[model samples]
Target: MVGIVKYNMAKISGKVVSVLAKRGPGSGGTYPGHIFTKIGGQESISKLASDLKIGSVLITGTNGKTTTTTLLIKLMSNDIQIRKSYENNILNSIATALLTQKGDMGIFEYGIRNLTYGIPDTVQKLIDPIGVVYTTISQEHTQVAGIKNPFEDYYKAKKLLSEGMQRGAIVTNADDPRTALIGLNKASDVNINYYGIEVDNVEDIGGEDIECPKCGQPLSYSKHFLNHRGVYTCQCGFKRPEPDVKLVNAEFNTDSWKLTIEGDLFNYTTSQNVKFNVVLSVPPFGFHNIYNTLASITAYATFTPKVENIESTVKEIFNNLDMSFIPPGRFEVVDIGGKYVGLGQGDNGDAIKINAMFMNQFVDGPLEFIYTTPDENEEEIFNDHFEVVKSMNPAHVIVVPGRKSIEKAKEYYEIIKKEYPDAEFYPLSYDEMGVRIEKLTELARDSDYDYVIMTGCGEEQAMWEEIKKKMINR
Candidate 1:
């Protein structure tokens, strides 16, 4: 076994290139050093995978992975010295668990885009994970692996996640088709747990009928709320089973980041995504902070069943959530001489979609927006942020252009003049930006426009800090 593992690790290693020549035509593809490193490391890795019960829970699917994983970690971290990991898509807690003595429980997440990065082989080991959570399904990486059927793609990845689960449980969104389809037959021998909102039974959004050892078929409606979940019926007929449970209902308030499930309310902080109805909210992400919190509740409640500790842990997290989740841009308020400003990147379209676009949540009346960018040519940068600028409806949109930025600002001013001819666009000189910012603060005071937004990169927080200090000192 040792020889086979070493040989397999080497077959795809970089040593083949060194043997080809010290300097070869396609040498960039693999380095001989990488081969040596990987070969030398296999022994330690195998031992790590085998020695104990490293409870791992892989959070996958598109949307709620971050929210769910974050909340799950929050619930378990207080008592169990849990380890975590991230792979761009989701935190890779498995990696964190392997590196720490305290990490007896590994709760990690992964980003999958079909064949391009099929589920990693480590997750398929029978004893690998004691738990798992699937957030939801949507076209996260449609073009990556050429998966024509979204549901089928979801099933394949799910099956791989549950492949070796002999002892631990598999948790799926009982409401999402992507997860619900991975039924008991998928892994009859392993433990399986299903969770959906109580509202789903009422709304008829989740679950279906089966002999569903867990729930019956024809999948009669208990209730359904956001997506698919609720009471279900089967030919054999079953309804929500005991112990491995279902939440009664959920209400999420985006503005305050408050979540209420089964009449038990929890307040989340700004860092919490409000659309946290895990299985219902899909990829690219929506503000489901509440759903994410609830999913954590469900996952912990269903698998662990140490109800008292789990419930107490959740209450503890909520108590600490407010302090941990606020002041995302490092502070909550940005002020300058009696006026306050909000900094923005305006680059992440999803936030805008939820906050401004669909929600019609833009501010009313005169406000100032200082948009900056590296497009030295101000005209390009101005044009680039045109949509956001237009959306801000600034009383006087100031383009703090960099070197070579005036042309762009002038172009925008001309364009704005053609319609709201009274509205103006000002291009501030690079050397006098601080002076210009002060001038804007004075204008804000004179005009009674108390709210300002500084949009761009890196400069937002610093400028806001100065603005706050100026306002305080004034």
Candidate 2:
């Protein structure tokens, strides 16, 4: 009884913080939750979460979590009120949303790098979410906070997020074996809704080999839709799960894409079967966003209380959708006075490949690749990134340090020099991020090549987005 009183007092104090935090940047998003946790403790989080009458849903994965969460929030918001948060993927962000937002449901994007940094199990227990959405998972951060985080441990950390759930639904990507395995393993404990692409028109021409999550042997892909995500089977008898929600057809154009998506999934709120088939016309947001579209739609169908409003709401939101829906610092192509430049964050191999694919569509002739090198202990990421650079067949390559380690960046550049003997290297210090951003922007802007693609490993907002803003506003 005393604990309840204390929690109420903490909630009131958190609310006051939320109301008075000046509402700028991270302060409004996470400070309230931090104060609440400091005063009422971590145990109080569950009580705050319980305020949602329909419970919460968390989106997590290597990529696409923010985009998927944003789309899901839009879809669900049309049907019912929802408390939501994204970009800042920590618990405090969600806690702040809970304190300030009034809604029946809570939607938050949660990112897990590894077990030590991300407490997935504890979050699952505290939030007690009714739905946990998994975007495609792949290797990105090989090391977290100077610790070597193996792929096995990273995969385990993602699994722990939904492993303890006894009710609700698991919305996952059927095309990605890692996420499919998670849904398959949890089929007995909860409702599993898988989303994927079924059309052959969209296929990845080349990609790296992926190991089967179930078996140690290499998995065989019948079709590759995106990097490490495709229709595949293993010797251990594990294969891609049939998608409950899928993109049955897609019509790609220069400006927009037409997607025919179908969904038949169990709604956790209404406890009934719901289905919808709708063709949405959306901005040419890239192939990765196709998965994001399916993920958000599947999750919305799985949790929305208004089942009958599914088709209308989806069409309403997506048909009129714009490129603005994409989160900041993601890949986007811009025209700078007749020069076509594609620039944004491509921190991981998978992400870099996608950015390349997107930029390929706009490359007419003589493309210059402005590459950013990863930091120390990230040789694996460098190797994957180098593969992408070679595939792009740029007329020129410029390498700069994307992270703090200028020495490691030099090492990576030397290897590139072997293949492209003319490749130039700039040992940009991480301390002077402003100078780095300026040089990167200048290289892409003043380049002789009409087609330029600036992407690799870099801070999403601070580096890439800033450079993009400078080039656009120049």
Candidate 3:
């Protein structure tokens, strides 16, 4: 029941997304709206508070919230209406929401620390009066949350989502077992809209093949899209959602992706999952970008038909259509002194793990690899993740010596050395490392394969700043 003048609407994902393509002031054109109103909710909120202007959508979860929020806001913006801001994290979410409604509908992205982990009550209250977007429940930022058991912490965060917000607010992501278990209860009064990846595609390194949230049987994947998402069917006969809209037969082309509605099969790509093909998350960056793109876009498509021109519109939004990575980190190549250096970070953050979640796309290649371990600042690196790095058997790993470097970083390298004995170890201070890094980057810029990455660096923030400065001068 969101207040709508019903000026005009468009079709997307066939029939997904709606609402105001533009709102507030200064908002000119329209894109797709992913929110739906029952017809009375608007009045209800208005009655709840005359101050009630537009409800916000807080897309929070352990992973993909930022990227997903970015994509949703981007797709949600067409010629005129657009998302306001992309804040640093959940702590700043509310602040971003207040900036400029100017007639444009508000779509806020919130980040939660495990559950009730980092944010104070006031921030929680902010979400209370907004639209709810639960990205997914997974293990992340446990130290700050004080929940070593990531699942429980993540699950608790999901439950906490219901404290604020109206009845039956738009909620998606049926694939998350924790979602149905916790969110279903908190949002009991709210209408439920569910979307999941392929059931059989469940690769429960820790999060899939879960019992039916309702029926308690092994869920079957009607088709696994990507990650823990796809169509699901329970023995009790509840299927992943008929999906008024589906991201069928998603196709990823390394740098970009394409998606289509289900019925367009014979005319489109041969994948049976036609309705769910691959499309860039918005700006359409690299492979990792695809993960967040699918979730939010699919759900948005469900409620709003404004996403039809998504592929075409994305090009316009990206401004610079290059899938640029945050350089000196994650697949970075540089030219220093005419020598090529491939640089990348092997941070143990959970998002990097794509064993089952990512296949060929997350390849350990580019010919040469120069691994570097950073000083741990706050987040500690778990041993298991480093073991995977060792398994890669790169040419060399340089553990930077610094006060901020993680205590265990060197220890983990010790672990890798046991497996990769010949792996040259150059324990250099930041000054020498910086100069050497320059030389590597210079070569990487020139040669086909010179520099690769400085894996497992905890002091990356400090390093990235220095690198940025060097690039500017160069």
TM-score: which candidate is best?
2
lDDT of each residue in 1-474, candidate 2, tens digit only: 229878988989998988887664422589899899888999899988988999999999999999999999999989888898899889998898888888999999999999999999999999999999999888886889888889889999999999999999999999999999999999999999999999989989895569998887999999999998999999999999999999999999988889999888888889998878999999998899999999999999999999999999999999989888878888899999999999999888999999999999899899999999888999999999999999999999999888888889999999999999999999988899888888888999999999999998888888887988899897
- Segments in model 2 whose C-alpha atoms lie over 4 Å from true places: 24-27
Q: How does each model score on lDDT?
A: 0.47, 0.91, 0.44
Which candidate number would show the highest lDDT if scored against the true structure? 2
lDDT of 1 by residue, 275-360 (tens): 12222211211233344555666665543323446556666676456423321222223345555655433322222222222122
Indicate the worst ten consecutive residues by lDDT in candidate 1: 266-275
Residues 1-474 of candidate 3: C-alpha lDDT, one tens digit per residue: 443342111122102322333332212111222121132222222322223243445566655665577666666656336344443454332332332234234565655665445542344453343446666665443344233535455565555665554542545565555454444555456555444443232233332355665656788864544334445677776665443233344455555545443211110111122233333332324434444544555434432333355445544444333434232233343445544343444444444343212322343543333444534432344453554454444454444433234344466457667766755454545556666556544433443533344334434445544553564356
Q: Which residue pairs collide, candidate 2?
A: none
lDDT of 1 at 268: 17
